[model samples]
Target: MTTIMSSALGFASNRRRRAILALLVVEALSLAVISALHLSGVIHGGTRPYNPEAAGIAEAVIGVVLIAGAVAVLSSPKHGRAAAQAATGFAIAGFIVGLTFTIIGGQPVDVAYHAIVLPLLILTLVLSLPKPRDLGVGRDQGPVSKSQ
Candidate 1:
């Protein structure tokens, strides 16, 4: 579609797009740090009161998913929006689940940070993404949406 193509090509009109890109970078870095913490046993926010091993595994999985999503975005600028959305999903799940775990066994501040802050950031970025229809050549306007 023209919208996606134009965004892919220039994306000059919306300055927020750059903010989105920056957030995506932050997400990638956060995930990597989380992965390192879990795998290397350097998790933050006080001592582990619950099952650290399980938490570590979960964190690693989330890290991998986010990294894969980032790769998808970087690999194809024209289709990066979808990739970013997918990454957001992983971020949402990780934050919620991690929040729950922290609330049950860790500090209240950790709970607040995970439950309130992280998800809001992720959702903000997700909502900021341009819809596929905005791409100008959406499936609805293509051969698939046409009746035979």
Candidate 2:
């Protein structure tokens, strides 16, 4: 019974991790589109970034980072967990700031984009957060003691 329950929990965790990866991919793609629009002089908004070129460059870099994070999340379990956490946290911060700026000083299009993306980023972060370890999930030992 315990084994079955543990397997179920493990499956759920894997599903959640995959969800996080999918969200990250979506975010990366969205950032790429935003970057392209800004760089192409298609989206000129009244906001903190007076220079659309610089903002667009930054967005492109962020998108690249997000793509890297998605790749990392598909790696080993420990590494993937860390990558997911970092990626989601960074995206959440960026989106929140963008949302605030858009709401205060930018166009409605910008506002709507930020508003929609921020919550999804938050959800990704939440899902990426580590949970308590399951008993006998993988190895019998958690980690070796340094003093040992």
Candidate 3:
């Protein structure tokens, strides 16, 4: 029974890990497209004059970081968790700043994009957090057992 429960938990963890990776990939692709659109002046919104090139470049960098995080997650869950956390945190901060400017600059499309993606990023960030076991929770302080 314990073995069966362990297997089930492992399967669920794997599924959740895959889902997080998929979200990261989708987000990176979205960022790439958004950056390209802005760079091409196709995403111009509102009357405020701002530098689309700068915003596009910033977003492209974030996308690259996200891709790296995804690759890391695929290779090693332990290290990848940190990478994903950093990437998502960075993205959240960037989006918040971007959203602030977008709202103040009166860029409705950009504002909408931030609105849609920001929450998803936050969710991904939360989901990628380490489990209690990973943080030494409920861990034995005595001599380690072979099974452990």
Instruction: Tell me the number of clashing residue pairs for each predicted model.
Output: 3, 0, 0
Worst 10 residues of 2 by lDDT: 1-10
lDDT of 3 by residue, 1-95 (tens): 22112211231266667888998999999999999999898877555545567678888998998898899778875566677788999999988
On TM-score, the leading prediction is 3
Global CA lDDT of candidate 2, please? 0.71
- Residue runs of model 2 more than 4 Å from their true location after superposition: 1-12, 45-51, 133-148
Estimate, for each residue in 67-126, the C-alpha lDDT of model 2 and write its tens digit: 888898777555676677777777777666566666666667777777787788788877
lDDT of each: 0.59, 0.71, 0.77
Clashing pairs in 1: 1-137, 3-135, 4-135
lDDT of 1 by residue, 12-129 (tens): 2244454555666666566566556655766545455544556667766766666666565556665565666677776777777777677778555446546654865576455556
lDDT of 3: 0.77
